[model samples]
Target chain A: MSSNSKDKDNRRRRRSSSLMYQEPPESLEQQSDQAVLPNLNAQWVNAKGAWLIHIIIILLLKIVYDIVPSVTQETSWTLVNITYMFGSYLMFHWVRGIPFEFNAGAYDNLNMWEQIDNEDQYTPAKKFLLAVPICLFLVSTHYTHYDLAYFMINFLATLAVVVPKLPALHRMRLAFLNPEPQPTDQ
Target chain B: MNSSNIGTELPPTAVAFIESAAASFQKIPGSAIVIRYIRSSYQNDPIRSLVELFLFIFAVRYLLAPAYSTKKTKNVHLTEDEIDELVEDWTPEPLAGEQSEWEKLENDRIPVIIGPAAPKTKLQNGRTVTNLASYNHYNFASNPELTAKAVNTVRTYGVGPCSPPGFYGTQDVHMKSEADIAAHLGMPACIIYAQSFSTISSVIPAFSKRGDIIVADKAVNYPIRKGLQISRSTVRWYDHNDMEDLERVLAKVVKEGQGKPLTRRFIVTEGLFENTGDVVNLPKLVELKFKYKFRLILDETWSYGTMGRTGKGVTEHQHVDPNNVDMIIGGLAGCMSSGGGFCASTEEIVEHQRLSAAAYTFSAALPALLATTASETVTILQEEPSIIQNLRENIRAMRAQLDPRSDWVICTSSPENPVMLLVLKEQVVKDRGFSRQEQEFLLQDCVDECLANGVLITRLKSMPPALGSSPRDQEKEWLPRPALKVCVTTGLSKKETEKAGIVIRHAITAVMKGKKWQR
Candidate 1:
């Protein structure tokens, strides 16, 4: 017992002398919380506002599409398709967040919102559930007259906000991706 | 306000001009004359005849456009990249050593020190700090009678009762104050504790225990949250002020309990939420309590001496019977103008708290002086019932002076509430491109301006900003800072109450207009 105690004391002395610091592990919530912009919770500064601005732009285009009448035909379909694609790219690339619930035909991803900020990794199948809302919305535009393309454009634009959240989806880190995981000591 | 008073201070000439203008303005209208035509049309027909009379709406809407648009009111709209820039600009310096700032505070005096609750507390330099953003509502702190009682009791009892309530600490004064509270609450018995925060913190754990479940508001005060923590029970937080959400949560609790033979459930809420300055819907809360068959523990920490016919609290204010609530928890530290807290319930529940409440069994008793102070203040409430009206009137005047839907300012609290919180609209904060610190600093500057101009206001402290926030999205880092809290007392005059709104508004606009954020 005496020998063991001395050994323990010597080990402590050496460890203390080394002066090496061991940082605490950050919680999944903390890690995910720092991974993106915090302002997404509020207005204007977060992905919500960016999404809103894109949505507004699409709405304004809908007014033009309605007024011009030329864009509604199959010929202007290319124009609408191009606009929707670009809108989707801008939204998914620029915005950094998504709404709590993105509703589909008979399904809702409401419960997934709380888990989004957790470091609990998700798959493409789970992340693909986010695209359902736009698919459903675009279908509605086909039956309606108010430039259904706007809804598709608006929905696709906000996709960038949620895509980075899933680890498997985001790429090209140098292009503007937040760090994967920092040391988190601070 | 009438068209009759428009021309030559009489309607006859005005009516003639309006009739003639209405008949001819249509022919005179061209491209640039649209507004003139509308005006001429409005003046000619006065009431726009019978059919198109409301065409004047265009003119009014056009005039009100600047005041109504959120975009027009806001000055800053940072792009996503700009937001990332600000968030990354100046990160909080992380400490080098192992000890955190909170741990260091335990060993050292706070950079800012607080005096005992008073009308005008002395600051570090012995300067009078009237309202450097204090929302303490401790009106009786510096009262001559209360202060004298404290002095006399300090000389006699020597500050502390020196024993727990279970021991020799139950003095005559303690019994008297408890009795006074019981009488005031219209309950069978009341138990007092060493401090106000501990009352709820101890009661929840003592009553609910580990296996029980507690349904609470998401925005309850910290003490209540701490109590919920101590209970170690499954806590379900309903959206703040949303009865529907509460019902949904309670229904789920009932469903969960259906499978269990014996389960304890409790609903906790505050009579007046301190953070939001809004009163809870007591009638709806009581209805839910019966519908769910869960016991209710209502914390009246802020509402106790500020509501009801004679400050009997939300029970009387909302006409809910005291018997409906299973337990009433209150803190005397604020508004009641004393230290310590009390739990009022039936004899059995009160006995359970006295026997098992950790704060009561382990903590020193409340000083005899504070017990007397509380009893004395209750008497003051009885003697002067009009003081409640005075406070209500001051709040009403303050609200009346500011447009409720103005884009410039937003009030989180209702007009009737004595504790009013006014914040710049979120859009306004975004427009100014003010960071969280910049916003707080600007609010402080506004308060200082108000103080210099002889009116004092306070900006509430927001939750500490999260460390390691995203530097990439600068706008995403802009936290919605807490609103300024301005509390009214019976001592406040009607004129000052009216002036308070103008003072606050002017101070905010002046501060916003004077300087620009560096980065």
Candidate 2:
């Protein structure tokens, strides 16, 4: 009898909604990132001799292109410039999140560009990354003898990669070309 | 061998190969430019050329070096034979460390029951004594109806499920028991585990991960502390049962997390503190959980089947809605006379634990008999609220004889609590100048004295700190004060309970005043 009455009382009382207690949902990307340990994908860029490896890679690429049969010096420099810019752009900016699954999707919404130095703009690593391409373009143009076609190709490749690293476009995504995927419910 | 000697004694094939390599180097286009550039860059400075060579070598070495180990140990290279010798020489320490004299004595002194535990239990020594140590508060263990149902279940389903719930082990009896418990607690869903001791420990890590935050009471039970440790979450402790301190800690945590992305935050505490025999302020906890946007994980193991008018647990007793708490973990072993535990929560949480909780997923399911017995016990508690009233009356009778009449000790338990914890008076402890260990010894003496006088009681057992933790790590560990535990049961009449309580009080007085125990 008492339990029956107690059940009635419980039914009469309005069950309090917990929605009021929940915090207003913000960008889940940032929130999920904060929920995990620091990202390791971008951290290697700050390690010892990490910058030197990029120059080594470019030199290796130049040598490889130069050894191709019947390739002129101008064509080799142009090929090196385009290849380096394309690789760097794909590596540093195009890839979203980490390749490793250890972080539990902590960096899923963040590209390597945003993940570098914890998304801090103008870090030393970022500065060196930005300078490498411009210097490469200058060398490629000088080596190409400032021919209009070769100069144009080198300059455009440099511009394509350098604009994304600017602080103004830190987290910007080209929506039409690369639409953000819907967040999967875990 | 010197390089000059090797050059002078070079084989004809090697010389021909070198000559061909040089010829090919000269044949390559831009070879003239590369030589010219090198000559100009060298500019009669050998250091510049040497530095360039060193840079090339350093880059190669850096790329070829093995990945660094995450562990902080130095990389010590050893020959295979040396490693074999080291392996042969190694002797592992014993799994369990050496037991102290007190531990060995306590192990020997443990009373072995000859039959089913009850108000009057026969010990291995062939003596019948009034039992107060077992948590048979309502004495439902020997109920004829429950026993009959259990026997029926065993006859129908055998002794065990022989598999975890995920496989073919989830029997109909288990589902009925889960439904009964969920309905009794007024929660949306419930999930049961095979054992009570590891329930919360498994439930904690299932939801709270490494980077989450947990604010727990300092006096939580051993299982809860272990759960917090296993979760690896950031833990902050507040003073036991102090609502103000809990509020302050919550505010401090919220302040510290400002501008950072929000992580899952939880406030963990117990319904009735098993060590201190006191109840938590549930309304205050719920309010603070809302105020700070933290979820509440309330462990009601000790208070679930013992508190409230209809045995709905602390939420019912304190008039707080069950939905307010995110998770409620309760033991069926304590008062329900069953052999497992349950967590009452929403359907989502219950479904989650079915797949994720370690004990539930890996351990075998509860026996069919225990499941039916738990279901029967929940129904009995709801239908017969007078059983709770009888327990409270026994508690009152026990307290009347022990609390005010005893001059050497005083009861620390709340009035409604059946587990009466009698601690030495503050003044008596101060005058005697007894350390924690000495007080524990005195309490053990009191328990022995009570048993000698035909009353069976126990002491509040304090858990040792976890292994591998340094002494400095235990500086902030909290231990309950030494006290004699007298768990009042409805199995004994009010008069019998009063008589047993008097025996407990006199036993404490005798132990405290005895010349042998005097400092």
Candidate 3:
């Protein structure tokens, strides 16, 4: 009995060492669930007035910032550009999953950036989104009259958002900034 | 067309205004840069400039378009008089179509029980007849012990819950009942819904969303069919109780889904079929579920508290572990003679249903009295194994009287099923060449004849044509064979049950021999 038990243990060890470990079944199940339904997170970007809404938000931010006493056009423009960039980044890249629960956690592992167009690298929507920040930077720089301080700040804000959207960084998680989804109790 | 000629032809005020506009445009900042940019971009090509102008106009038109359009095609232009004439010519369909002749007859023939449903029930016609139509297989609805318990519960908790279970409607009794059922079925936990008919319907959509695959038996009861419709899940049907056909369908689904993402695949079936009154092969079903890695949602509404040795349901009867089944939906109103339904499964599944299942979360909790009665009945089933045996024995006696002895009809139910379903024999049907509607009419005649002979039974109730669906649409659906339902009960003595069974057999014979039914 002891020799048989040892033989069984050795076989188990050999099998474990021979094969490369694959992801847990849960991840595959989640992937299938994601495939079953179209991701709502990405589809909303294509909706009517979706592009217009971004322009409206930037305008609103400019107006609101301008209402503050003694604010200059340069300051207000830079603030609008920064605010829009931050909001877009939070909405598109930082959040990992949809706001709605109807899809059954299919998008839990993916952010809106990776979910758009089923993770295709460069669609029209993505291209339009990438152009928005760059245009805003140029607009802010022009309004600021190319002041070194404001131009640098606007450039940095644009870079912060545009860099993460590159296809190479798709589904890549930063260790300190964006950790993997913790296993839910369910 | 020359500038000098145009200037000379224009009025003095117009010419002066044009000159001022040009002067102001030239005065604007970065006007030279704008001209340079356009010149470089279009490269002085008139076609490119025209194209750009057209694109600009198109973008403006698109942006200005209305958000929602009702009609895809262009609207027809009609004169006012023509529109009035068309409006006058149109007629609206009726809200509900007139009931068919069969439906009217059925409505008129519904027997009104004046008192409690029992083995012997007094109908409005002032006749006490043997009642074999109710889901009171053990006749526990009128049991003194259960009645006392129900009364005690009512006194303590009142009649109405007044809230949904997710709210304050979940009383201590409800928890006790859930625990009792979970323990009785040897499952981890159980959740109870207010009504049995809507229980499975709600539980189905809770887990199985769109794109999820469901493999169901063709002969599942009406409630299950409704559940499948409401779930909107992809459904595949196999021949009823045919394991080979089920495996074939499962394998096909798996193959079709190959390399695609794994969906939540389910095998939805009943332990004892309510439509056909036959038992499912549970062991083989469990094997198939494991083999395919598909979860099993077993509706044990008819078999629970009727089939097992101590009435723990199909799992006990087949000696399969209850844990192997993903979800077990059972009716408390059926053989248990209480009200509501319970879904027993693992803790996680039950917890999920608490907030997800519509009938449980939206509807008021089951009344406290019914919960107490359900708890007590489950306990009685556990303590006294003979109640089930008594029911089985009565079933046997009923079978002996009707199944082998009847020449016109044959029992389609398994021997263990207390609800004995009698369908016209194949030879009888072939000889008469009866269609589905004719068979239903013949079964109704048998039920009426049995009632006149002081035996109360019912015909199998087929679902009404689904709302807004034509009879032609219903033709594609699988309809259970029209049959007479005779529910065996322990309330009656073996001799009495056998006598009623004989009366039923004679009733079928008499109906078949009647000149009105002759082919």
Candidate 4:
């Protein structure tokens, strides 16, 4: 009976140790390390690029408005208007990649996941919150009717480009701020 | 003959057969209420049952009796001389270079009915014009010459096709007209149909089947929506200019339909939204089509002969190669001074549609004279670039005048193309002297006022679906807002633009003043 009890005890002990080994270790050290290693500079660069494009658009509108009044004759004004409008449109296509949203596959990778983890360390909601003001500003500009309806439409169209990137940007910041808890074998 | 001989040899059972037939006929009640009420007084409502009985009797006697051929025929043999006389009386001489005999008779006898005539003082004043509600003669103001031209062409072509396109109806002019359109569009082939609505309804269904998926803009033409509904295909609506929505829907389609084959994936959209008067992002749409591998169909109804460097369409305007777009469907109704639609595509698509599209195969082709007019118009549009330039200038001038008055007006998009919407406020709506029934009446009034002052404008009624609101709900809410869409054709002059501006401003001022005075 003692030998049989001993065998039972050994089998139980073996199963417990195997389960322990299979469980992933909980390490605060790794979590802290990941949280601290976010690429803040790259995030700022993207944000700056977005703002730069916005400024460039506003500048272009100003340039067109200034130049249009100087042109003499209705025919020349019409020509200049068409040229500026088409030019701006082409410039928009060149600068912002024609306002197309990126496919999910473009961001579906381990690097993106790591970026998201790092991003979480910063204010996760910052990008989305920022987009709200940008959208409102665009809507207001559209309502103001500066540079005709095309400018307003172009401004509204930027939302399509900006909105999709917000989640990715937010997730990147979140990933940097908050690392997910590791599994524990209790 | 054998059956008749067999019947004659049979024993005389006529009385028995007639009795049996009579018994069977009696089983079906002459009046249905008799059967229902007689079955049970307590089971059914007597009044309801009586109405149903009356309906049943009426249906049987009138509707069913017509199919049974109850009329008896008595044959009367006529001699050859009598037949020749009959033929002579029936055949009337053709009314060459003049009104038909029937039309002449109708014209002579028109005072058969009369209503309360216009006030005598107003009629006498001439300035206070009592006949303000007539559009037939309004053509005199818009384009008196156009009326003369139309009449001359009708006189030349005669009345109608008299037969469908398949049977001695495809005129040489029709073929040549479509060929000319194809050459102008730089498309390999084209098929012109009577109307755009019919063309879309017929061709869209012919292209795809139940197994296919049609990805269209949420704001496409109503006929296309109806066609997709009839096609019984999976229809996915991408958000307006939202490529991400399209991509997501495409991905889902691909995932769900992994191994199973689909017939076709068609993406349909307009080159320019006729209602909003905004140019579509065709290049972006084409780019998505290329990336997602779907066939694209563009309705360049509003854009043709108006947009692009060569007046090709939005595709040409955006510098997108037309070869990439699978099919281009366009209408020559508004700017082209013609009344028909054409589908410009490869020879294969044209052949497929010709064989399958009910609109093309069943409807009568455009009459010879109208086809000639369209052909002439195309030549004019292609050869005379100044027409388009003048149109562009007029558009710019109008926009420049209207834009500064931001409170009262808002131009949606694109001055290059000559469609503008004059959006009015709630107060302006009240000022137009229109009831809710005449929601379009205000715009019509503006048009009339414009015509009275010597500027012609064509107005469009916004479809309920395109308004992006349910009609029932909108009606209940008393949202009577309507926009006046002015489509400037190629012939609009600089003087006309200035005159139009003055007239539009005056109309708005008058309405506003009228409303205030009424209050």
Candidate 5:
């Protein structure tokens, strides 16, 4: 087979695998009403990538502390982690994504996408605040010159996870909700 | 080695990166084989090993994100074209992700008849006092105690709560009604809504929301469907009264959400279905609830005052403990013969509804007089338990002697249920030579004929469209065939009950032959 055809086959396999959970609309409706295109899209497309990064970062730090005795500056890493958590929690939950509880039930007590819309007001401020704590930690700890090894290992690992999810995170469409469809390629 | 079917190869740099990553991932000590060897390694240093296991999981999820087997379901996100097709030719796709927006039920188009007489079926249809077609089974419209309470409340507080519940609209009588209903249901707390229409509609949304899972009966009422829509929760509708189907769905959902503790799951159903006048099997439901750890919400709007030994509803009637069910929502309109709705549950749940429920917060409170009447009705239910007993006996009398032939009229619901439904035979409906609308009109006309013959009966009125009903018998209609609902009241004597059965039987037969039986 031609290399080009093989590449197309590979792409087809990727699409089908990523979408293994999908059924025809009628079957999906029969199975679970909330398990529609919009939610599925929101789940994969707009998933909180920041949260994924945080977990990976924390795991790497813990490995450093456990395996190599983590040279020093423990307090700085802890504080930096704390701020990342706060910023991501607020932004993801309030604006970019929906928590399970808010989206999982028969009737929504929460107003329709009101919180998602309201997310715009203070997110930039919260993001800015997040940077301050990280900057302070770096300033206090003499951030560079310690170890490229740990950073390299964790960064490479996280990129593997984050790269594939990026498309979905950007393009997630909440199926039932009537938001205008946007082109995902951008 | 097997490069013959190779896809377009990546650039050399990308290939080199992939090779190096594979080598590095293999070299990382706990990252590769730790998961497979975890059980054996756990005994070496359980706590440290546990920590290692978690870290390993994190690393693997990150490393294999592309290959991660996520358990999300495939959904048919309709293309714009599919939406257009559905819009033009709306079909019976009950569980279709999007319920057709343009399809209208008979009740949506037809107006309800307003009855005037108390305890008697004297309906006011424009000019003359016609037979009251539907509602308030016992005609408590003229009960002395209820009337006195209404009169006193009107004299004191006037007609309505003009403002919403959060405003100055909450009356003392509303409190009493909530308390009375809570006590009657043997629940810790209760919250009353303005009217029956919004009762289930508001209550279901109060607890459930998007991302949650709700497994309800397919034949649930319209209000429940509306509530489901608002919550945007994942919902699965099991077939009506089919416990096995409910179990299959619950088991599958529990399996799918195996590790997801935060994703709430509930089993929602009606005690006596509004569409079919059938009772749900509560004992079996409680058993399934226990097995699947699903919170149960029983909407007993039709069964509240009519069922049970002392009128404690499905729990009393079915001999199941009430505490097993998490929430109970019902209307006061049934045997109580009042206007309004109440939800009874744990104190915490009721409190949440008070703070979170949109209908309660945003809508006017129940009228003070109506609340007083509801409270009085509860008191009467308890004090004169005979009210429920008499109703049951009347039901028994109606069910016993009224052995309707399959060809004539068949009682579809349980005999113990005070709400008796007499429906046209399926074969007959299919065989009939009329158009779908004409068939509906003829069935409705039979109800009118029954009313003219001194028995106040009504056709199955439209409810808020639930995953509502059955496929049409004759046409491409997506609704249950029209049935005559003869609500047997406690006030009916044995003779009256017999007369009702006779009248209904005669009506259906004569209506089929295209003849009208006069009073």
Candidate 6:
């Protein structure tokens, strides 16, 4: 009985050791340590850079607005506004890491890798990036009786980016806005 | 485009045919009073109403396109090479099965489903047959004494609350349940909803308006999307689980609304992804919410009764402050083994929703038995910690047994949650291509096999991609990544777990062997 017990113990030890030596299962902890942290640093840099560009573009637009005192012309003013809106939207995407392909059907692919690798770490960032195309599409096309295909494409693009991000943002906002009170004696 | 021509072009025979067809259609099959009422209201202006009706139908069809077109099937007429290529692209074997003594031992296992009813037996010809599908009244984990106390309260209180909360519907039991949930969640107040489905569909749009922006997860439940559609709120979707995408959307919304008036901005998420079984990072999500200044709403339907040390849900599991969440919605259907939904929030928010939310104001209040049962379940969950431990053990055992062979079988994991995804063998997929009808058949077949081996399972279909009005051919077909979602309730036992594992293994192995079952 002693010998059998010793043999079982040895087998268990051997199994555990073998498992330790083998590669660990792919997990969020390990993946976040590698991909999410490093990617976050890159994203932060991009965000700062994009913010800088946004400031510069706003300054340039201010200059244009200042020089064009006759800004009441509907056509030219609309053109200027469009350019500014497009630039601001692009800057948002640059910071947020919006995928180039904005089709709603393919939106799942946009954050597929992040969700698989490190869901918690990447979910918020993906949610933020989804807003760029949607805001642009909505503001740009609100007045137009465009082709059905054009309207549908924009609608799809907006939904693709908006739907996924809304949930994450919702949770984040809820947390920030409604901080639990620290217990204190009156 | 002529006004007369638009209503014209109907021959006398065609008109007669239409009249006859409409009459027969009303008599045939099943027709609801609501449908007949709506149809009769539009009968006066037939031509104009017909066009409007067709348009409305088209819009409804488009909105629900994802649910409609998700079923794809393999063409039987395809050439061998084409079939081979299609199979190779769409479905591939994730793991190879091993034939061993252990496998053989597992093949004979049987599982039983337990519930509130008595065990049933059947007679086959002249012989007595023992029924294995007896899972009614399997509340071994539930304290009978506690259940009795709750039932006594319910019996004394009567059956249902009957009216919406806005009316004279708020009973003492309902108030107590709400208070209990709020205290457990550590939130200021709680609001009860008839169902979690209505809670999301109603409350979300109530908080925001047309000009307001809503950013949500693409994989949110369908009812939420339907609510957003009716609200006409400009929605921006971020990639699932991508925090960067969320920040970008926030910045864009803020930036774009600089000159224009921006209304309320809201963000929504699920506590634990019901489909993938993935946990959301509550702390990080909170941080983003603070930075963005958008109201956050989390649906903790799947997580409330299963996650955390105390089963308060992801907020507790992640060690985040529950009070940090603006609104926390959860359903008491699965884990509580009862029915009803509760939203934990501030008193002001609860009051506002009770007053403004249409569903909350209109829907019938929860039945008394369910409220009593759920409240009792909560008390049991809080007092008896070992139930969670046993569930965890069952989850761990199942994972350890299944993960090694995940390649041969398709299994998706989400930490220690009771839910797990079981992917069927590639041969099953080859036999049943991506068609919705075929997928349903495959699911039914799998359930049958499991039942034959004495295991019961709840089957679910995946949320399809949103598609708008388009011709059938033009509409993008979303294929469900076929999986069997396994959920372990408090009623499951160690013996039941082992038996279920064996039964599941046998069902999977039998299917892999290409053994056909009668439909």
Please give the CA lDDT of all the candidate structures: 0.64, 0.82, 0.83, 0.57, 0.63, 0.59
Candidate 6's error at B178, in angstroms?
1.0
Candidate 5 residue spans exceeding 4 A from truth: A1-186, B1-115, B119-132, B259-262, B397-407, B430-438, B451-454, B463-478, B515-519
> Which has the higher DockQ value, candidate number 2 or candidate number 4?
2
Query: In angstroms, how far off is B70's CA in candidate 1?
Result: 64
Fnat: each model in turn: 0.00, 0.00, 0.00, 0.00, 0.15, 0.00
Model 4: residues with Cα > 4 Å off, grouped in runs: A1-186, B1-159, B424-459, B464-481, B490-492, B509-519
Model 6, B204-238: lDDT tens per residue?
76676544678887656666676666454568887
lDDT of 4 by residue, B1-519 (tens): 134755664445865687777678678867465444346532334553353345345323332322221113387899999999999889675656476464464355322213322211132223332221221111122344544665676787665576667776777778898899889888899998887677777777777754477888776766667677655456878766577887887777667666553447889888877656677787778888888788998888778877876578887789887878888888766566667788889999998887677788888877665676667767766876676777777677777666556345556657775777666655544665555545454455565565455444545554543334656655533121366665544333566555566666676555545543233
DockQ of 5: 0.10
DockQ of candidate 2?
Answer: 0.03
Q: On residues B1-519, what C-alpha lDDT tens digit does candidate 5 reach at each position?
A: 234467776777887898898888878987665444544445444554454445445444444434222235488899999999889997665554643432344334333446554335434444332233445555476577678878999999899979888889988888888999899888898999887878888877777765578998987877777887666567887888899999999998888776444567888899988778789999999999999999999999888887787777889988888888999988887668788788899989988888678888888888888888888888887888776777777677777644454365677778667777766666665665555556667767676566666556667765533344445422332355566776776555767776666677776777777643221
Worst 10 residues of 5 chain B by lDDT: B62-71
TM-score, one value per model: 0.55, 0.70, 0.72, 0.49, 0.64, 0.53
Give the Cα RMSD of candidate 5. 14.7
Candidate 3 CAPRI grade: incorrect
Prediction RMSDs, each to the true structure: 33.0, 14.5, 13.1, 36.2, 14.7, 26.4
All DockQ scores = 0.01, 0.03, 0.03, 0.00, 0.10, 0.01
Misplaced by over 4 Å in model 2 are: A1-186, B1-94, B468-475
DockQ of 6: 0.01
**Model 3 over residues B189-217: C-alpha lDDT tens digits?**
99999999999998898898655789999
TM-score of chain A of 6: 0.33
RMSD of 4: 36.2
- For residues B168-255, what per-residue lDDT tens digits would candidate 2 score against the true structure? 8999999999999999999999999999988999899888864578999999999998888666567889999999999999999899
State the displacement of the C-alpha of residue B497, model 6, in Å, after optimal TM-score superposition. Answer: 0.6
Query: Backbone collision count in every prediction?
Result: 14, 0, 0, 18, 22, 69
User: Could you tell which candidate, 2 or 3, scores higher by TM-score?
Assistant: 3
